[model samples]
Target: MRVARTHHRCARRSVVVGKPKAEPRASWVDEETFDAKKKRASLILRRLEKQYPDTRTALNYTTPFELLVATVLSAQSTDKMVNIITEKLFQKYRSPEDYLKAKPGELEQDIKASGFFNQKAKSIRGLSQKLVEDFGGEVPGTMEELLTLPGVARKTANVVLGNAFGKNFGIAVDTHVHRLSWRFGFSDHDDPNKVEQDLMKLFSRAKWFKVSHLLIDHGRNVCFARNPNCADCVVNELCPAARVPAVRKRAKPSPSA
Candidate 1:
């Protein structure tokens, strides 16, 4: 009888721990190994392509020079705020020469709503003067030349090159993009340069510009900072950061002794 019981116990143990079960998938990046991670990133890009087919520049501008200036003014300011200020500012200063010729204080007051009036004033004036002297009052297209201008970093240059010139030089890592990319497991690095490198490796060249805009829109509308609406999120199935609440406790009936 003991031998029979031992045999049954051994059978139960075999059933319980025969083969190792696969790890529970908590994130899209975890769905595959390193090589497959790149492929998964491509799939995510495809999903975004359908979601935001018309994804483009949020900033309004007619000319490349206008777009370049607007991108510079967008530093530490929202696109809406910059647009509000630029609506009149653009009408007044039609060209780089006009901006260079205008009084610094007047231009400063004109863009006061966008914040950092003093520094932004200097940047606008200095950048304009450089354009007049160096590029013959035209915004430079290449990344190398664009960086030579004051107040024009990788973020601004990338925005102008991608949106205005339709060039895919690098990814624009805005605050929303940086946060969302990290949450979505696109990158572990906090530095924008490193993040762009990771994204370039994962996504194809065609998605370089569009990917940032899609992520930015999603971050603002859904995955907001401080309080994300993960419950109603579209990508919640693949998101590791989805908020899951604990189940409610139920009262148990007393057992008869």
Candidate 2:
């Protein structure tokens, strides 16, 4: 009886101490998720670059000063509106000296069509004053100096530096750039500066110059703010959140209660 009890105890000890069979470690990610993100970014870059090979600033200007002035005027207005206002304004205010001499009311009227003309006039004048006082009446090339001017922020500075001076300090994250970058899952930040940092990490500096143009063109033509035509888009396959615009068969009647 003693020997049998010992044998039973040994059997129970073996059951408790024996190692469980090893289970295979499952992978968190398969090839599908990895391939999808890669393909999406590639398609987006390729399609956009091909469509707008010559895409650039639409503001018509002959000099760096004009570019600077136009960018300032484009704060809340469209490029088309700014262009129209500047058509005659440029001829009248030929230099920073001319801007300084003009009456505030007169300059306000000149740029009235661009909306918020009064505020814009003040910003432009203030910026021109700084240009004369600090940079000898010339648009500064570096980002640091450009940011010192009135009405100049990182976005404006990036545009002036990249387009006017051919420097790629940072990507210009305008409304279009911001919207497109987020829609494509490139970033989730609400701030333009943060979005720019995210894109800078993903893309090379060599591609920064043309990236804004590509995004602008895409925003205008395909990925519109209200109704994005995802089904017709070239990169729709890779985009997980690509929403196909639903075609309405008939207009719904107003409720008469």
For each candidate, give its TM-score against the true structure: 0.81, 0.79
- Top-TM-score structure, candidate number: 1
| lDDT of each candidate versus the true structure | 0.72, 0.71
Residue 216 in candidate 1, Cα distance off native in Å: 0.8
lDDT of 2: 0.71
Report the C-alpha lDDT of model 2 over 1-257, residue by residue, as the tens digit.
01110000000000001111121111221233635544566677887787767777767776778888887888777777777778788889878889999974999889888778888889889999999999999888999999999888888888788877789999887777777776676666777788788788767788887887677777766776666787667666545446663344577988999
Cα displacement (Å) at residue 23, model 2: 41
Q: Which TM-score value belongs to model 2? A: 0.79
Pairs that clash in candidate 1: none
lDDT, candidate 1, 94-196, per-residue tens:
8899988886488888888877788888888888999999998888889999999888888888888997778999998777777766776777675777877
Error of 1 at 224 (Å): 0.8
